[model samples]
Every structure is written in structure tokens, then in C-alpha cells.
Target: MVTVNEAKQKIIANTEVLTSMSMKPSESLNYVLFQDVRASISLPSFRQSSMDGYAVHDSDITARGTVLEILAEAKAGEGTMQVLPPGAAMRIFTGAPVPEGATAVIMQERTTRTGSFVTIEDFPVTPGRNIRSIGQQIMKGSIALPQNILLTAGAIGFLSGLNVEEVSVYRKPKIGLLVTGDELVQNGSSIRHGQVYESNSLMLRAALQQEGVTDVEVLYAKDDLRATIDALDELAGRNDIVLASGGISVGDYDFVGEALQSIRAETIFYKVRQKPGKPLLFARRKQTLFFALPGNPASSLVCYYEYVLPAIRKMSGRSDYFLRSVSMPIERGYSFDGERDEFLKATANQDVVIPLDGQESFALRSFAIANAIIYLTVNQNKVEAGDHVEVHLLPA
Candidate 1:
């Protein structure tokens, strides 16, 4: 077994960012941009009215109660141009194009209309008032968004507004899941004396979906070595990342290790010195990455969050690939003398972190509600109330 830090280092050293692909901005949510996105045309291409008001030259409004004739009206999306004569106003609505020869816009609330004329109450209307100048948001031919930025909903909308149809982004990874166990049965099936519900696939699949990974295929294998090897071969052939749960430990029925050997995969690390997830395995075959996680639900999830998730993020060209760590005060004191490092499920906020109950590998009652994981090394097993500890926040 290797140290936790050693395992992480090996995984990072072997990982490489995936190639970039061109895709429509509408379908590129949560993807990292591979290149700078430039604006082809200035935003708001024309001088626009910011409110429902009258458009007029600044000199036209001479007095507070000056009455001016209301020329042709200009509504939003009006293609034809209307010229505002001197000493006259043009009726304009919000987002409407400012009529020719008009320099100011007075909101409708500050004026009263009678027939074809309007009286202005607010005096000394400033030039360019309530008018959005061309390219006020972004200039044409300029970088609208920088490279390496994560695309959110707001980003997508902004790009769409700029008329950007497609963008280059890091490719999203496709994963394959292989589950190994003869005693595991799918949920809703009747359980025999030694059988248990198989929940790792569903739980792990959901976790992957939260990371914006939707292309995943799941397969099951029995305890037999040949079946395990065949399943591993099939999954590794078509996926960028292969995930296997169970059959990693030194048990009699375990066959994942032997299966990997049969496929001639290069093992990066076999295990880590960590509680709840010591039997973790990471390997590589050419460009594909593989992780064999422990069978227990809680242990499997912990490994996924700590190791597999970061790999996926890195492959997708994200710089913030690891779990965010914060040092905060503990709510209660705890003591443990475990031989390996321990990752305890906990709930935390900006102020404090509280380690929860039922921390066993097989128990998930606490893990289900946990938003963070409190890390405790073997040498620092004992903690006191109000002591500061390292906590890793989970992804939402």
C-alpha cells in the first residue's frame, strides 16, 4: 500500500488533458473553453432606448414644461428609421432603436401626452440619458470571453447574444462501470440469506451525472476470474475511463486484480493508507484510466470523490480538479487510534464542522446528509473541541 499523497501524485502524473472539440455554445454548459471567444459584432448593434419614453435632441428640451410634437412612433424591432425634427420628440419604447438625429431619451413617467404632443416635466434632460450606446456591453472583434473559463448558463446566454454559434472546448469523458459480486442483487429483487442489494452502480452513476458526465455504460460480472477479465476488457476498450467496484481486496472471491493482470494494464497504485477506502486501485492502459473501488457503498463513494472525480475534471481541462479544502473549528471532540488515515463524513458550513455518527464503511446514513469530509491522518487521530481541522467540501 502507498500513502494517500503518493497515490494522488501518481494519478496526477499519469493523467493528461483530453483533446478539444467544436460544439454549439447552447450544448456546452459546464465545459471549459479551449480558446478565446471573440465578438463578431458589437452588442446592441445600434443606439437603443433603455426605457419607454420619447427620443429627442438634448437642445430640443429647453424648458420644464415645453410641449413638443410626437413624431412617428418607434417600437422594438422596428427596421424603418424615423427622423426626429428639431423641437420635436419621437415616441420610443424600451429596447427600441433611437431615432435618427435623437441624442436623449426621457422616460414616459416624466412626461404627459395629449393627442400628438407631449409635455416634459423633468427639466434639463442630459444628452444620452436612458440611451444605450452601440457596443456599450462589448466592442466588436474583441475577446468576449477568455480561454480556460467554465461555461455557465449566464455565459451561454452571453455568447448567444453575441451570435456565437459554436465554441472549442475540452471534450467530456465517457465512462464504463463494471460491478463484481455474486451476492449482489439489483434493488426490488427478493434477497436470499447471503444476498444484498446492489446500489453502487446507481449511486456512482448519480455522482457522475452531478459532474456533468452523462455518457456512461454499466456492466456486471460474477466472482469468477474469466467473467471479471472479460468484463474489464470490454469496458476498457470503449471508454475513456473505466470504473470497477468490489473484487479488489485479498479475499478468496475477489478477481479484479487478476482480471487487470490478464489485460496487461499498468498499475499506478494498488492501495492507499486510508480508512473506509484502503482497497482502492488505480491503473492505466495507454490513454484510458481505470479505478477499482472497494465494494462497500460508503467506501466506494469516498474513493470516487477523492480520486476519480479529480481525474475527470483534469481530463476536461479544469484547473480546480481537487476537492476544496478549508480549515475550520470542530464542533465536538473525538478520538481514534486507527492505523491508517481516516476520512469521516461530516456536515459543515463557513463557520464550523461537525463529524457525524455512523462512520462505518457499510453505513451511509451519515454520508447521505454529509456536505463535507473531515480528513484525519493516523498521527493526528485525536481531536479536541474547538480544534481546527482540515475539511474538504463536496461538490453540489
Candidate 2:
């Protein structure tokens, strides 16, 4: 078995980044940029009003209670080409282009408009106040967004404001899920004496959705070598990444390892020296990467978060793929005699971290309430109260 760090390195090194594609900004959320996004035109291409106010020459407002002639009205998207005359102001709305000769804007609340004249009640009018200069946000022919940036809603909106319709981004990988276990039944299906509801796919799909991965196809394979092999072969051809849950451990029904071998997939690593997911299996065939997670619900989810999610993120061209980690003091002492390193479900606050019970691989009740995972190294089995521990914060 390989150490956790070694396994993670191997997975990252072997995984290939998907090719880039041109997509609309609306459809490119969560995708990493392949090229630098340069601004085609300057943001706020014209000097714009930032508020619904009066645009006036700064010199015109020499003192409080200054009166100026209302020249014209400039509404957003309907600015006039007429320049402002000296000692005159324009009724400008937010986002309207500031007329030439105007150096300042005063809020409507601070001014009293009477017919064609307006009185500025406030003193010391400042230049460039309440006005967004041309290219204030982004200069034309400059980098609006650097390469490798993850596209979020704000990024998309910014690009859209710059009139960028399409973006070149790393394509999201297509995924295939193979669940191996005859004892597993669908959630709505009638259960037999030995049957259990199949939830790994559901949990994994939801997790993948959180990462902005939605193109997933799920298939159920009976605990038979031939069936597992056929399913693996089919999924390998269809997806860039294939996740197979269960049938990885050395059990009578375990056939994932044998099936992968029969299909000629190269095993990068068979197991990792970690609790809850010790039997994790990683493999590859040509361009397709495979992860065979442990059977238990908590084990599968843990392995997915620790290993599979990183691989998926890398394939999609993300820069930071791992969960956020922080060091915190344990609220209470905890003792364990386990030989493998464990990721204990826990809740953490700014002050302390409290390890929760039901940490067994099959137990997920604690996981449901956990906001973090406390990493306990194999060599350090016992933790004293107030001792510092590394915690991996979960996504909210």
C-alpha cells in the first residue's frame, strides 16, 4: 500500500487535463480558463455617472448654495452628444455617460431643482466624485482575467459587461459510474432480507454536482467477474473518468480488481494506508482514469472527497483541487489504537475542534453533521485535549 501523499501525487501525475473549448460565458461557470481573457474594449468605455445626480463643472460649484442652469437630461443608454456649457449641469442618471466639461457629480438629494436651474446645497464639490472614468475597471487590450482562473458568477458577469460572449475554457470531463454489488437495491425498490439501499451513486452524484460536474452516467453491475469486466469495458470507452464503488477489497464478491485486470487497465495503486478507505483502488486505460472506492457509505464518500475529487478537478484544469486545511486544537482528548491513518468526522469552530463519534467506515450519522475531518496520523494514535490537530474543512 502507498502512503496517502504518494498516492495523491501518483494520481495527479497520471491524470491528463482535458482540452479547451469555446463556450458562452453563461455556460462556462466553474470552468478554468485556458487562455488569458483580454478586454476587447475598455470597461465603462465612456466616463459614466455612478449615481442618479447632476453632472456639473467643478469650477461652477465654487460655494454652497451655488445655482447652475440645467442643460440637458442624460439617462442611461441615452446620453446626448451635446457638451455641457460652463456654469451648467446635466441631469444624469446612473450609468449615463458624463458629458464633456463636467468634472463632478452631486447626488440629487443634495440639490434642489427648480425648472431649468438647480441649487447645490453642499460645499467643496470634488472632481471625479461619483463618476467612473473610462477604463476605470479594465483598460482595453489589457488582461481582464488571467489564464487558469476558475469562472464563477462574478467572473462571468464581469466578462459579459466587457461584451465577451464566448470564453476558451478547459472542458469538463464526462463521468461514468459503475456500482458493483448484488445486495444493493435502488432507493424505491422493494428490499429483500439481505438487500440494502444503493446510495453511493446518489451521494457521489450530489458531490460531483457540487463541483459543477453534471454529465454522469450510472450503471449497476452484479458481483460477477464477467459482468464487472463488461461493465468496466463499456464505461471506459464512454467516459474520461470512471468511478466504481465496492468490489475492491479481498472478499468473495470483490471482483473490481480482477475485472480491471481482465480489461487490461494498468493499476497505478491498489491501496492507500488510510482508514475508512484503505482498499481504495486507482487505475487507468488509455485516456480513461478509474477509481474503485470502498463499499461502505462513509468509506466511499471519504475516498471520493480525498482522492477522486482532486483527480476530477485536475482533469477539469482547476489550480487548487484539495479541500481547505487548517490547524486547530482538539476540544477533548481522543484515543485510538488503529494502525492506519484516520480521517475522523468532526465539527470545528474558531476556538476548537471536537471529534464526533460513529467514525467507523460503515457509520455516516456523524458524517452528516461533520463540518470538518480531523487527520490523525498512524504513528500518533492518541491525542490529548487542547493538542493541535490538522482539520480538512468541508464545503458548506
Q: CA lDDT of each candidate?
A: 0.93, 0.91
lDDT per residue as tens, model 1, 1-396: 998889888888888999999999999999999999999999889999999989988897888998999978899999987788898999999999999899999999999999999999878989999999999999999999999999999999999999999999999899999999999999999999999999999999999999899999999999999999999999999999999999999999999988998999999899899998999999999999999999999999999999998899999999998899999899999888768999999999878999999999989889899999999888878999999999999998
TM-score of each: 0.95, 0.96
Error in Å for residue 47 of model 2: 1.1
lDDT of 2: 0.91
Model 1 RMSD to the real structure?
Answer: 1.8
- Per-candidate Cα RMSD to the true structure, in Å, reads 1.8, 1.5
Off by over 4 Å in 1: none
* Top candidate when judged by lDDT against the true structure: 1
Q: What is the C-alpha local distance difference test score of candidate 1?
A: 0.93
Q: By TM-score, how accurate is candidate 1?
A: 0.95
Mind giving the per-residue lDDT tens digits that candidate 2 earns over 84-168?
Answer: 8888889999999888889888999999999999999878988998999999998999999998999999999999998898999
